[model samples]
Target: MKKISSKMIFGILTGIILGITMAAYAVSVPSEQVLYSNSATSETTVNGALTELLNLSQECKSRCPEGYTCTEKKLCKRASTSTLHTETCMTGSACHVQNNYKTYGHGDTITYGNISTTAGTLKAGDAFDCDVNGNGHYESDSERFYYVSTMNNGHMRADSNIAVLAYAKTSNTYRLSSGHISYNNYGNTSYGPQYALNELYNTTQWKNAPEIRSGHITDSSGNILKLNFSYSGYASRLLTYQEVSAGCSIPAQVVSYNSVGVMDSGGPLSYSCNFLLEDSNYSNSSNSVYYIWLESGVDGRNDSAFDIDTYSSNVSYDSVTSMNYARPAIEVPLSDIDY
Candidate 1:
């Protein structure tokens, strides 16, 4: 009802415009507290996911035991302690023999070949508890062996993944069936060491031991012969000539005699063969003289196989029919040992 005026009209329009502007600003701008709360939730979600991923990566790593190292395959392996090789004389004692002997932190004798002696902790020369004589008793003096080497599962025996090679403390005599035979032929035949060892697997003497894996046999000339067994392989067989004389700088030889039939040469015993020499008391007793068979057969001579002659303390070859010491060697699964 008041008289119309420009100033009044202008004031009324200005107030309405200002009120609308303020309401639009209030709708668009959220409170500082609200903004901070929303931001925190987003950051928390992202950070939590990152933390979980880090935890998973850490859980996947493997921890190796003492005296072992972690291989690139994420498995545990035996670590060599020293370059120096030595033997421990365990004569007339609970442990019959120890080769490549190295004193562990604690002088502990593994009474059984089970999980108690963890495979990772076993170094070369560690005595493994086994039933050697088939007497139904796992005695240290009866059928025990000292570890000679450690290898991957498929390296030696296909079934024995992650295995250790063990050598006998003493020797046992066995006769190779009389014949003019080559290594390849002898290994395939039932009368040879290759098949003879497998036959023992069915007996108490080697019922528990893992069967031998077929391997190559090399002669003194570096010629290779396959031990293609008809069955899985040998159960308890003799050491290879290469393995026995591995440590020798001037390795011994295996040869056929001339028309007159005489050994052509002699050489130093290998570090491994040295162990057998001392344990057998070949140095002290003349009666202890004997020949030990090697897995290798003479390269050029089909009638002969390599042997360790006690008299000369060197490598030699003898007639396949000759009776020789069958020093059993076995590759056992790592899982059989206890930690």
Candidate 2:
């Protein structure tokens, strides 16, 4: 565990060059380490010394572990790609390359994190693994989610510390009970209307994801939905219109379905965005598709909430008490996710 430095390596190299020069031209010195030949040409001796230096440098570079390059500073880190040969080297000792480098990318599959997932990456529409019940197993249809967007403080590069928004990969039959998220001027609040979805978010969903820290989302009327635990924060909520259409090609079209799972009105709202259309798990069969609830309620409709029909990628609305599904979405730090 000895620390190697650039200055020390430089000093050793200087000594070797001076020793070789004296050994080639000066009177023979009785030293076991120095090899002196009377008939050898100076050019031959110089070439021999250069070959030894090359071997010495290569030996140290070979110790550098994967994902980490031995830097000129002799410090092991994940900053640059330059290797040990870019600088001088030590002859006998191995360069110390620390085992601390790891790479994270937009589509890199990770095994574990503060919240675990079997299939997931850092790209939009990618699988977001979350098991809500602490049962160690996720529902077959609801086992994964789509990463909708990256927040202001998030990133998708190597060694990045960030947070992203995740939406349910499939739909569920969770009902959105009726009422109104009413507020009074006297600081009194009523969660009775949005209570159904709130209960599911705060209690049932994301139960196993403790790393989903508190956050906030805005509504159509400039209202704020805090996902904090202190006041009335939700653990997992629905997506919004702006969120779904951020970098996607969502058209002005609308699609709808009845409570009995029948397409009643509107046409397909086929949308396309980064990797969203590339999800292999997305269903093409109508039987497995359902409407996904969004966080924002209809602009002027108090008893209704916006929803996206999975069958058509179309946006629509439904009564709060209707039997549509709740596709929960959450925000989590990228650092909390392991590579």
Candidate 3:
């Protein structure tokens, strides 16, 4: 009886050592951690915790909710909410955090929102994609690229309301809707920017243009969700010039009575279009990157137009005729589209 008891104890000890070794190996990779249930407690034994964590990993690829990020495929947290995302987020919208699998070189295909953009190679610093209007599918040109924008997923809406798993800087593009290209500040809305967005959504050179349509998500219940992927130009809804400027990360500047657009409530917001030249998103920081143009002498107000000299780093706003870049706020709701 003593010999049998000894044998049983030996087996248990051996198994315990082996499990600890395996668990250590499992979480050794940097930033990766074993998934633990919110209900897990310290009272749980080490062996029990390890066993549960290991099993749960196999059972679920990720426990992250939509718009939430899965850190190292273990720690799940809410994505950061910039002003742009907060303004555009719908009542029940939950934004997704950028997921750049550290294994970009080897992990499974990268899915930005609902689109499979980087199969493996196309390089990006953070694994974010921007082509949502056309579905980003260009068979003729296999080599695709993305604009590194200041915008994040919180402000992007998926095409046709399909839930996508990613967001890009262009999500701020929808801000164009706040003003009109043809008529600077028409009434209270910017019809010009809105027109451009519509053009992208409706007209396309390709055969199967991406449009708002019904899509499906493969959940455990296999439930089908109506993915209403559309651009909310002011989706961020941050109409105040200060709000937009801060969201765009523009350099601070002086301003007074700089009314650029009208408000939905009647009068134009005081600082709606306080245009500045220095805050463009491109690395070069030139007017070519992106900028906004206010209606010059329409009401005999300050011209507020600007021009950047690439050579001297000088900005001139005297001329009203010069065409300026329009930095609009946009939102993409990636709640639809299949995974």
The clash count of every prediction, one per candidate, is 12, 3, 53
- The deviation in Å at residue 173 for candidate 2 is 7.0
**TM-score winner, 2 or 3:** 2
**Model 2, runs deviating above 4 Å:** 1-122, 130-143, 151-193, 198-208, 211-217, 220-234, 251-289
Candidate 2 lDDT: 0.40
Error of 1 at 53 (Å): 40
Score residue 57 of candidate 2 by CA lDDT. 64
Per-residue C-alpha lDDT of model 1 across residues 1-339, encoded as one tens digit per residue: 234332243344345446556876667532221211121133233234334334533433445433333342211222222311233333232222123332212223322122214544644445455654445455544454655444321123233243444444434322234211232334331233543342133324466666665554545554554444333534566655555544333344545467786668654453333444433434333234366666666767656677767545566777666555545666666665432
- For each candidate, give its TM-score against the true structure: 0.47, 0.40, 0.25
Query: Which portions of model 1 miss their true places by more than 4 Å?
Result: 1-126, 131-138, 150-203, 215-227, 231-234, 247-263, 270-273, 278-289, 334-339
Q: Top lDDT: which candidate number?
A: 1
Of 1 and 2, the candidate ranking higher by TM-score: 1
Candidate 2 lDDT over residue span 2-40, tens digit each: 443432433555676687677778676544454322222
Off by more than 4 A, model 3: 1-127, 130-243, 246-254, 257-290, 293-322, 327-330, 334-339
